[model samples]
Target: MLYGVCYYPEHWPKERWPIDAALMREAGVNVVRIAEFAWSKMEPRPGEYDWSWLDEIIALLEANGIEVVLGTPTATPPKWLMDRHPDLYMKDAQGHTRGFGNRRHYCYNHAEYRRLSADIVERMARRYGGHANVAAWQIDNEFGCTDTVRCYCDHCRQAFQRWLRNKYGEIGKLNEAWGTVFWSHIYNSWEEVVLPAYTVFPMHNPGLHLDYMRFASDAVAEYQQVQVDVLRRESPDKPITHNFMGYFAEVDAFRLAEPLDFASWDNYPNLHFDEKADPLNSAVQHDMTWGLKRQPFWVMEQQSGSPGGNFIFAMPKPGELRRWTYQAVAHGADAILYFRWRTCLFGAEQYWHGLLPHDGIPGRRYEEAKRTGEELQRLSGRWLGTGAGAEVAVIRSYDNEWAMDIQPQSFGHRYMAHFKQYCRYFYDRHIPVEIVSPDMPLGRYRLVVVPHDMLTHPASAAALHAYAAAGGTVVLDFRAGIKRPDNRMEERTIPGAYRDLLGLRVADYGSLRQGDTRPVTLVRGDTAAEGHGGGVWYDIVELEGAEAVAWYASDFFADTPAVTRHAYGSGTAYYMATEPTPALMDALMDRICEGAQVEPIAGIAAPPGVEIARRTNGEKDFLFVMNHDEHSATLALEEPLDELIQGVRHAGSVRIEAGGVHVYERASLRRD
Candidate 1:
């Protein structure tokens, strides 16, 4: 229930601090985050430290009844530190150094940089760990922002060599795992290994490239662990988190969040007033962040107005910002903090508008935010322990995503886009879904969807097989289990590890050109429906103790199984040989969910442009209905409920305006 803004006392004059604090309190802001990017201000010299300004702001905000979430200033080291150690700069793929003009320039593997980061984090934690107003600590700014996750510097190269040595144990094992015999690229010694950069062409050894990605991700995680260890020692009572960016997959978010107490994300949907955007784009990310820890999270940097950097985006409509905030909460966000209280007057982010304008005038956006805060205050404490209960989970794999990026096989075959495509169907029907990693247990979910997971581990395959055998439905698509964890092709048939579980084998496959599609016809007992297929790739699937639910209608692969279903011990396993059209996917999901007895959250499909979700503790249940369309939506209620936002009771039906949100609490019904 923490509601606030990301304030920057360092960005304003000292005299304006009091006024800002008062205005924030009046606007119902109960918390504020500061000093995530104020390294230079905190540490002016190499070893000198200054906390006068920060101390004053924290004390002033506390007096005004606002708590503080202090962040480690390690994201941006002081110019003095960078100037002293020039080798700390991260080198790009072309061996060009990323200079100090922007943030996150320091290489994570650099020894000097790690030491300095640890020193600054410990100093900040020790100074404010016991402060009455300090509530939590953020480890660093966005970990992989600005493509800084991958560094080709000598420090990273050496660290990567050590990492490979640790993983493979010996050079001969590394050679065998990487399949280095094909290109005669076998390494004689550990020193001979190099990063996958500056190759003669874009093609680097697939095994080497995949390992480098893992090594780089580990390096970043280890770097954060250093600060995490220091903060836990210094501030054991405070919670820790790192703000992750939406749709960012440069580093493994699950791994990054493993050390923190909970998860938080920076949500900037960047939707304008007139733009026709998919609401699922933001909803899926919220689910992803929530799935990181499987708990309620915080929106660390919620977009208040138009977001701008290299290019400016259109401003949100009057009620759009409030709707976006409600959307975040609808998923799993227990706390919401707007990106900034006021826009900056100078710097690259000068044009990034906040609640208040650049003139520091409390205008339309500020009033809207104030109204949201007021409404939220009335509804506080009721939703403190509630979280989404999802029966369907979409399996996510960072390793497979990275492997696909290395060799996409065909154009427009994106990993994330494919994930969204499948999730969108469930979203449209208001079915609660969770995005989970494949390594996690699958028994909790009734249906598990694994889409285009190219690199499959044996343990993950075994888990899926067991889940299906134990009365869970599993849906897998083409190119799944085609490669091993080492990024090499499986020695067995296509769909290597999944062959037995899926009850099918891929005879052959081919990539389709853009704007070309093969027709498919799905047959269910007494009816058949035709739909388009193959926007990216398709596989000719041969049935093995399975039933063909769909078949290609045209092209050389006509009459072949495009989709199949096989009943394992107590459950069913479904497989897709090609990407289906939206209509076809809907039909497929309908049949699968019907068999699994899964239903939408509202007991029926929601109207177009309307989104529905539910959150509940063991006692109380809350339903969120949002209308993202341009016109009003009228929904029929199944039972009596209280609309908490406006404190109205509705039993028959309710009309929601455009860009409106309604939160309903069931009346007189409590579970034991």
Candidate 2:
């Protein structure tokens, strides 16, 4: 594994460079990411360059046996550039120019800004491309931070018009796709089309907004591509990457990750004192980021220490930081790098702490990071090139997410929340899940869950049908297959073309007000329970050939089918018509898992807060047993285990302390 921290050599004086490098080597850090926000230092004046300081810093770090991951420094253009061309700065939808002072201020579609980005990246890459100590290159700090990805300036408007022209050939087709007839907003010429900006109450044509989102995300990607092309041309040997903000929905991560060698994300858990953080949220986010390319990724910017401030910065307990670091490794992070090596005393991020405090003292966080680095070194060769494997897949779509954001009928509708709840069912039981794109193959998994595919592609639906026909179990919740790819509602019944697999037709559906709920009595085989269902929406179902596994017990539509199941070809399809309660979701998932014959990593009787994940290299499997509870617990193992961390053998049981992690290799599969 690669262990490192984000280092900003420009932030410190020349005298502090050697000290930082020596300390990093002593802490066993093998890598460092440098120059992400060093644009001003790199180019002080137009066409002027300063390479003496950066060269010395890189050489000092290399002499200390530490490699470097140089960043393009395009996220933050210098003040000179902004002052010279104010139009290059991003402008909001209300026609106000978002001024400088913070990072990511340049408009992506600005011609001069794109040219400057390419120029600086080319220069940097050419300078350090062949350095023996340089391992990789980070494209920028963060792509879509501060909502700067979308710009409503005239330049962007023209660019968006051109993009629309390229996507839909003629004006008539654009009108047809946008359904402009509804509001008399038809466009006769390309120039007549403008951004969906400053609309009445910020509500415009849903199709127009959806297309604008796509255009904006594409603009960001296109801007990054300028830098990427420069780096690839100047430094063909080194790999490229970009650190994404977790759960950020502005720019499409999938599209941005397409040109990179692999993906990486920043992980910052909202850790509060005396409260156990939900490891599942970060776990799922990690899984999602890793799934961007279906490969093991890096934690490019992990929180090292809590910032000293009044805002949500709670210090980590004794072993929490180290345990959280290991948790990232458990979720398939091949490289883990903290945000900063030392706290910044002069900047907007001064309060955001690092391994070293503002006093430049080696504190508890530094010691803990050292220990974590040592542990990583010890387990280096054991799991090389190995990553977590999964047998269950959850479907996610950027188009669906964009559609929901465009016109969320219910006030409480959040696509991530709904999908997270669906994945929680498997994650709670130690069943590793691959949060996959909707376009990927589904035949490899025994079970596939579709939480909210509001704008499903016909190809995806057919793929799911084929998977189900081949003896796979498919679970789909409310709002599945509700619209076509163009963001228009399906003319057919609810669930659209998937009606055959669901074997049900939605007779009626409505959104419930806040705090309103209806009871559901779930019955399957000999198990029966009264559960409540509440959310923004619910659907009343008419079973065609499906069985009513769950029915509403209260409200005007009492005893109506709330959940249904149908057996098609050699498999089964389960459909949920409403947002299920946690208890109901557990019971329903239990039945679905049984039908698919999918077994958890361990038995189902395991206690709460026990996280089990397995990583494999086809010949060997390493099991990671993590205790996330605040209290100690005993874990029972079915097979003989050789503990890798402790180098011991245990056949039956082992005691794990709170926030402890145990790595074990099955005794039968141990090579030595």
Candidate 3:
């Protein structure tokens, strides 16, 4: 495991570089990331370049035995470049050029911008690519931050049209795919097709909007590949990765991760607004990032202290800084780096706290970070190359999310919220889960859950149905498979392609306003109970060779099926017809897990406020037990086992302190 921080040598004076490096070494930091936002410092003018400063910084860090992860500073274009090409900036849906003052303002499709970006990346690679100190290359800071994805500029419009032409080929096919006849949007020529911007009712043709999302995401990936190709060509030995933002939907993270060596993401837990930071949310984010390449990932930029920038800021408790760092490791993070070495004394992030405060003094966070670094070093390499082995895989798709975002029919219909709810339910019970794209292979999983999947790709749907038919349990939630890949409504039943496997069809459904409720009664093998659902939407389902597990208990759809299970081929498919509460979802998950024959770790259910994760190196399994709450909790172990952190062996039981973690290597028994 690697311990590091995002360091900006350009932000500090040359005289202080050694001082900062010494402090980092004192804190046991082994790696430091630089040059992510230092484009202006690298190239002060359009044609002029300055490499001496960065070369010195890299040499300084290398002298201290700390490796470096260099970033392509394309995220922040130099001010000179932006000023020279004002037309290269991204334009809003209102067709007004978004002025530059912030980073990530460049239009993705601008030819001049692409050329400049490639030039910079090539120059950086040629200069420092082969340096022994450079271990990895971060392509960009964050690919699609600030919703700068879909642009209305002429460059983007022309690129989008070209992309459409390549996809559809003919005008008639384009019209049919976009369902253009209904809105009188039929295009006579390719030039007539414009961006789905400024629609009259705020909702354009669904297919048009969906394709725009695809094109924008593809453009970002293609732009990244240009840099990737250069880095691979010049510095073939160093691994390459991009720091993805948590739950960022602008670009398909999974697809972006496809070309990289591995995956990584920035995590800011305390987006504090008086709301309790749910540690499970961060866990899911970590799992999603790991699932990108089905390998362990890095927390490239982790929150060190209070996140304050024109927002509410709350300092972490004494033990929280260390605890959260370990929490990242617990969830398959091979490398954990703090967001910054020191808080910036200037710019919009002046208040965004770091391990070291702006005063350059080692504060409480620095102390905690030092302790964490020592602990990680002590346990180094024991778990490297090990990955979380999950029994359940939840299918997540950016295409479905994009489709839903284009038209979220209900006020409470949040794409990520539903997906998180499903993850939270299983995760809270200590049942390990992997959040994968719909296209990933599903046969290895004991069960598969798809939540509110509004759009369906034909290949993915076929793969899912095959998995279910082969005896793997599948769970499909409401609003799933309602639209085709072209974003057109299916003429068949709701959950069109999956209807046969589901053995149920949506008879009627309605969207519910906030606080609206509907009573659903469970009826499975004489087990009967009532639960309230329908905060977002509810469906009245008609069974076709399926057994009703639950039915609506009130309203016009009274006694109608709300949940059903069908035996398809050698397996079963479960359908959830409404958005259930956390408790209900957990209860249902328990039943589903039972049917799927999936069991919790070591035959134990994690205590409340505690999470359990298991990672295996294709040999032995290491269990990561994390107590999230502020109070201590006790656990009973079946046999004596080694606890890595405490360097103790426990037989009967152990008490985990508040925000404490225990990594245990299960004991092996012999039969004589």
Ranked by TM-score from best down, the candidates are 1, 3, 2
| Model 1 stretches with alpha carbons more than 4 Å out | 271-274, 524-531, 603-605, 667-672
lDDT of 2 by residue, 1-672 (tens): 789999988888888888888889989999999998898899999999999988998889889989999988888899998999989988899999889878898888999888988999989988999999998999988888878888999999999999999999999998988789987998999999989899778888888889999999999899889988998899999999999876788988888999999888988775445345788878888888878888888999888877544354766677777888878888888888997799887878887888988887887988989998998889857766666667789877877888898877777778888888877888888888888888789877888998787887889889989999998899998888788787877888888989999999998999888656676777432323644454567898899999988887767877778889999999999998888888888987898898897778752134799788777776777788888898998888776778877888877767889889888875223221
Of the pair 1 and 3, which is ahead by lDDT? 1
Candidate 2 wrongly placed segments (more than 4 Å)? 271-276, 307-312, 524-534, 603-605, 667-672
Off by over 4 Å in 3: 524-534, 603-605, 667-672
- Candidate 3 whole-model C-alpha lDDT, 0 to 1: 0.85
TM-score of each: 0.97, 0.96, 0.97
Clash pairs detected, candidate 1: none
Q: Given candidate 3, what's the lDDT at residue 173?
A: 99
The model with the greater TM-score, 2 or 3, is 3
The CA lDDT of each predicted structure is: 0.87, 0.84, 0.85
lDDT of 1 by residue, 1-672 (tens): 899999999999999999999999999999999999999998898778899999999999999999999988888887888889999999999899889898988899998888888898889988999888998998889998989999999999999999999999999999998988978998999989999988787688899999999988888899999999998899999999999875788899889989999899998877444455567888999999988988999999998988887678878788888889889888989899998899999998998989999999899999999999898888857877567778899988999889988998888778998888888998998888889887778888899999887898989889998999999999999998888899989988988988888888999999998657777777432233545455577899888888898888777888888889999989999998888888888988899999987778753235799999878775666888989999998888876678899888877767889999999886323222
